[model samples]
Target: MNETELASYWNNNAPAWIELSRAGYDIYRDYLNTPAFFTILPDVKGLKGIDIGCGEGHNTRLLATKGAIVDAIDISSLFIESAIKMEKEYPLGIRYTVASATKLPFNNDSFDFATSFMCLMDLPDQEQAVSEAYRVLKPGGFFQFSIEHPCFKTPYQRKVENAQGDIAFEVGNYFKSANGTIEEWIFGDAPDELKNRLPKFRIPNFHRTLSWWINTLISVGFSIELLHEPYPDEEAVLNKPKLKAAREISYFLQVRCRK
Candidate 1:
């Protein structure tokens, strides 16, 4: 699919996504990926930052809470509207706009830092998005982003339960690159009571290899600073058993690169 088509899919999925994610249903993000992402994130106090694919501005607000001047953008207008509504109510001084990450609206050297939380995989042109981030960041600025682990979360993934009810995750298509593939599902960790009442989110996933991501950043003039594979700890697994798979194999990958 084209960028416009990808945006249209996100627009359709935005309401359900915002509602569920705000209600604490996105457990992988809340319990595993996001916490680890912030653990390694550098201080952003008094810095100017842009959050690409801000998604109702959750992580963007976190940046604001850390004393950064944050401007956020998402291609889905509905998502941007919800983010703006929350910003107005909370008064975090964040600027939320509807824009694509592949073609950012900012000029060169516009930001001290940039971020995208669990969003790069959903973008149509991953290379261009990374390039835009590199373009907007000033020298010595960094862009930190997280996404599902490319090796583990592929186009073909299956959860198999044995007779003992032990779950095993199977992944294939690691070498394959998908343009835009529709993946219709709700947050797996959400309580059954709430999940039964909500419609599944229709997310358009674009899959690329881990090497592709690394090479793209390097090609865009970003020096790789850190690579993190976030998995749940034992305490987290005890609290959320659904995350046990992540303990065995990482669920998310976070990268920090300097321009």
Candidate 2:
């Protein structure tokens, strides 16, 4: 799907998906419990922050609770509305706006910190987003983000159990170029009858190597401060046997960079 189609799809579906499943809240909670999240964002008190691609404003609320003046933006109007409603109840003083990540509406040097969670890969014009991040952040401000681990988490792979009942995962083309194609599944809480009603959309998602990400940050006038490959916690391992096994092999990368 094109950018407009993608935006429309998310705008139409995000409210129900987030409210019904509380996926956004759960994700934010998981981030809070992870070592990578705390380590990447130490001492955020009283800072001016912006969360680009802030879906339901979970991270923005978290930042505000930590004393940051947060402005959260998303392309989806439905998402912004839901976030705004939540903000009213929570009263974190978070400002919600409907804006594109690639074309942020903020002025240059307007923020002391910026964050994007699980959003960079989904963007069709990630270069523009990176540039806008660099433009908005003040010199020496931090721009941190987390994305799916490109090396081992391709969409084609699925978990399986061996004869001994040990969980195992099978993945292909670890060294595939960033432009490699893979099928993605968009599963949520839609009813079985409505499942087929929703279209399966296909779009390009670039998978950059670790070095490529570092170089891109450097080219955008930013320097990498931390890079983490976070593993699932012990409890998650016990409950999610397959994910637990995947954690042993390292499955996610979190990056912190300074502009």
Instruction: Give me the candidate number with maximum TM-score.
Output: 1
Worst 10 residues of 2 by lDDT: 24-33
Candidate 2 Cα errors over 4 Å, as ranges? 23-35, 174-204, 239-242
The numbered model that scores best in lDDT is: 1
Clashing pairs in 1: none
Q: How well does each candidate superpose onto the true structure, as a TM-score?
A: 0.96, 0.82
Residue-level lDDT tens digits of model 1 in 1-259: 7878888888888887888899887888888888999899999999999999998888889889999999999999999999999998999899998999988999999999999999999887889999999999999999999998899899899978789867788899899887778888999867788678878888888899999999999998999999999878899989988888777777889999999
Q: lDDT by residue for model 2 over 88-126, one digit each (tens)?
A: 887988999998998889899999999887778777666
Q: For residue 132, what is the lDDT in candidate 1?
A: 96
